[model samples]
Target: MIQVKKETLYAGMLKGLLTTFDLAKIIIPVSIVVTILGKSGALEFLADFAAPLMRVFGLSGKAALALFSGYFINLYAAIGVILTLSLTLKELMIIGVMLMLSHSLFMELAISKKAGCSLFYVLLVRLIPSLLVGILGGWLF
Candidate 1:
């Protein structure tokens, strides 16, 4: 049993598929928003909203797209953009942690729901800690 598990691609595919199903809620909605209303005008509002907060972390409004894109898409996509754009490894490490700590928001919520927990509270668990860690890591590096 352990040997088969060790040799299996099925295990990885299963995990990925399960994750996709769980995150479909948040992912689907966000994707629609991006597809239908993600023009610069649409995101400009967030510039005002996130400016002071992001400034504290030494990032700009443009970084929010990186965060959101990382959260929404597979990590490879985010990393790909970072590599293609020639960001430093220090920057990529920070980005990688930020993405790793939070992906498939909708899917995880559903998982907790099945387990009889509050998704909002669970959301706070992921959001607050990850941000704190990412900030500290970004600063320390």
Candidate 2:
């Protein structure tokens, strides 16, 4: 026997739509803002400030903005920043790998704390692996 109610289907569709809308709310604004910052040279300033450090990861200084966005805000924001820039495949790969390892630090940290995990340990566990992987990916690619 199988049962699929119309109301349940409608509710599921609505929930999916709402989730998409929520993601769009964050992604669209962030894409626009990063685009504006790129055009206005603000990202260049940030890149310069982070250049020396970013070089270690085989990324340009400008990529610092994407990393910052990914770490603090969310991966979608980082994607927006990345899309605005003209990066090589290798650069993109390094950033992609790094972001996969660690993103949404503030939100995840709060969640971890609420779940009774040590904040410092949570941060260290995520960040160290991200950095190491970034370094290795940079070297390999």
Per-residue lDDT tens digits of candidate 2, residues 86-111?
88888889999899989999999999
TM-score of each: 0.56, 0.87
By TM-score, the best candidate is 2
Q: What is the C-alpha lDDT of each candidate?
A: 0.63, 0.89
Give the range of the ten consecutive residues with the poorest summed lDDT in model 1. Answer: 76-85
Best-fitting candidate, scored by lDDT: 2
Per-residue lDDT of model 1, residues 11-71, tens digit only: 8888989887856654555555554434546656765677677655555554565666666
Query: In each prediction, how many residue pairs overlap at the backbone (N, C-alpha, C within less than 3 A)?
Result: 2, 0
